[model samples]
Target: MMNLISNAFLVVRPLEKRNKLIDEYNLIIEGLRSKGINIIELTSKEHLLSTKYLCSGHWISSLGKGVVVVYPMSSLGRQQERNDLVFDLLGRKGFKINDVVDFTEAENEGFFLEGTGSIVLDRLNCVAYVSVSKCSDEELFVEFCEELEFTPVIFRSSYSDGLEVLHTSRILTVTESFSIVASCMVKDKKERKMLSLQLKKSGRDLIYISEQQVENYVTDIKQVKNDKGDSFVVMSKSIFDSLYTDQKNTLGKHGEFLVFDCREIERQGKHSIGSILNDIFS
Candidate 1:
């Protein structure tokens, strides 16, 4: 599989405190386009409800080819944010609607899986790792794995006080050459080892991050490509600052990178690069 995405899908929905984010949003879009990456902006609906961060487009993910999987979201705001417009736009863009695994109905059963935010997909290796939380349902995860033919690794990740992390990307991130993970995310020693072994078996070098870094949103990143075919990981200045010099060197060995000055965005939306952008076609 060609894992590099040449085109990106970004949503324009603002958070409840969005008056200050318009500039940040435009700069991010301009930066991505400047790198020769195609940008598809999804316009927000007319709903006036206060959505804290529905702009992430977390209710669906493109499963390569024309296949798109609509997920079950915990937030009613996000569920409502998954409008039909994205699908219509994709259809017009010639993305074949091969099949859609509509897990949206699972919300009635109290099971929620918020697309890529609740799970990290190693598409090339066909492996998915989900940190069990209110937003990530194990049964639905199993169903997703079966439909996509992936090995599912489900585990619990929490903070020092036992509050579970809401998003899998907060602690576990998969890049093309390495996996940046928080060992503490897997509370059980044996389970952590098993997860690490699985990644090693799948051929990814491991880079362990500290709990402090995870708390600062360092894992919230994504691997992207430039027009010249060079690979780079997009991150925030906070993510870059949270890392040690040596850790940065090791991560740089995998790919070049771009860091955005997004302190205000993080303060307003509590999200970084990976959270704001989604890829529709590459």
Candidate 2:
């Protein structure tokens, strides 16, 4: 679980102030840590920015039980950001990573699959939702599904203006009990219908959002439980505002909202609140 956001960001260079992003990221980290979310912040002097829509911190995933999946990024420069040193940092932080599944080899074949950005894993239901894009490839996606034994639900997230969504996390988010997705995230009606039906059949309540909210990153929230078993849905202030009253009401039915104003990072990083959170399961 390495955090690379508080330092490096490749978007909005004009209005971006490193100090502001640092302050906001620190605040978010403190808030989550208070709620018993174990986090490790990896520091690097290089101003490396990986993918345009993908969070640098989200370039890899802690797949629980000492296994991690390192992604094959489209940016060659970003690939250099993660190396032996990064893994060593995680090891020092008590992330017992005994095995690493490297997906970077696909870069030679011109196929790339970003971690978490390419696929949204419904861990409990054994399902995965992926948006087809340059950042996500079907071949690499199927390999990941087979490795995890998750049923893959393929869809193309296209906006009304004829733009395909780049990151799956931007369009949908799933938790243990529910999922929030933008109706316009998937352009294929049949695929969308299948996803909706599958989610419902799997016993998850759906909180559907609009394309506008998806652009605002409202659905990229993360649900976590405190040591006392209190549940919270963590999100940025902007995302919170983007939600409809009924949507907030629906979330309230499931968990408390941990909202903070992270406009600076959200704008420049193009990421939501949970974007920086890296979970290393015990």
Candidate 3:
């Protein structure tokens, strides 16, 4: 119910290509911490072969309600990233990790669901908007929804280049009172109407973005708040810089803006600010 982020956990990779990502992660984490937010660190190790750098492992939102749910990694090397050690570490930190859902067997057969990145969660409304792609499985998504007591709103969202967008966060930005969505990627008019209706029913204003903006990953944003109860919107510098003055002003009306440089991390093409964010509940 709290739109303000008080605590978060970030996962980082130590690979050379991802070094900048760690720095960017640190930058955002530090910035949020400076505002009195608590941050937990989950550093990836070499032994976690299957889980190391895959987006699936870092999609922390799947483990909702402060319950850490580990998804079965499809990639062999990536599976190691979901080592029991990480879960134990979180438990030691006092995080309430419910059951770890093992979909490894299904993953081996090609079924997959990449956590919060693949599906955008409207926590307040108990709805999950999922964009089905190679990394997203319809059956698994339904099962996940059933488990979490969420209603699944599934659709396909593709980029202008004809490639399916990897994560829902790339094209959809949900806030407390408004949701910034990339309508261009949502091809089905009927489905789009349903999505719009759902947002309206949930008391959210829809701010539609063009395909051009989505292509540049300019629509991705997250809402946060400082300790004093002052709300802020956190986004990559690229997204912030690309926003039209009007769009920026509209967002400003909602809250203060906090932008972090993420070019190097984006270049690595694996993680984003949303991927590594795990909500910490006390």
Each candidate's lDDT (Cα)? 0.76, 0.71, 0.65
The per-residue C-alpha lDDT of model 2 at residue 16 equals 30
Tens digit of per-residue lDDT, candidate 3, span 1-282 = 523243444445444445665676667777878876555565566644432263433334434455555564445665555545666666777766665565556676787776666677777787888887777787888888897777899888887678887667678866666688886787888877787788778877667788877755665566765557677777788777778888887788777787888676556653445444554443
Better of 1 and 3 by TM-score: 1
TM-score of each: 0.92, 0.88, 0.85
In Å, residue 207's CA in model 2 sits off its true spot by: 0.4
Worst 10 residues of 1 by lDDT: 48-57
- Candidate 3 wrongly placed segments (more than 4 Å): 1-6, 13-21, 47-66
CA lDDT for candidate 2: 0.71
Output the lDDT of residue 31, model 2: 78
lDDT of 1 by residue, 17-85 (tens): 465676677777778778876567667766635343544447878867767888887867667777778
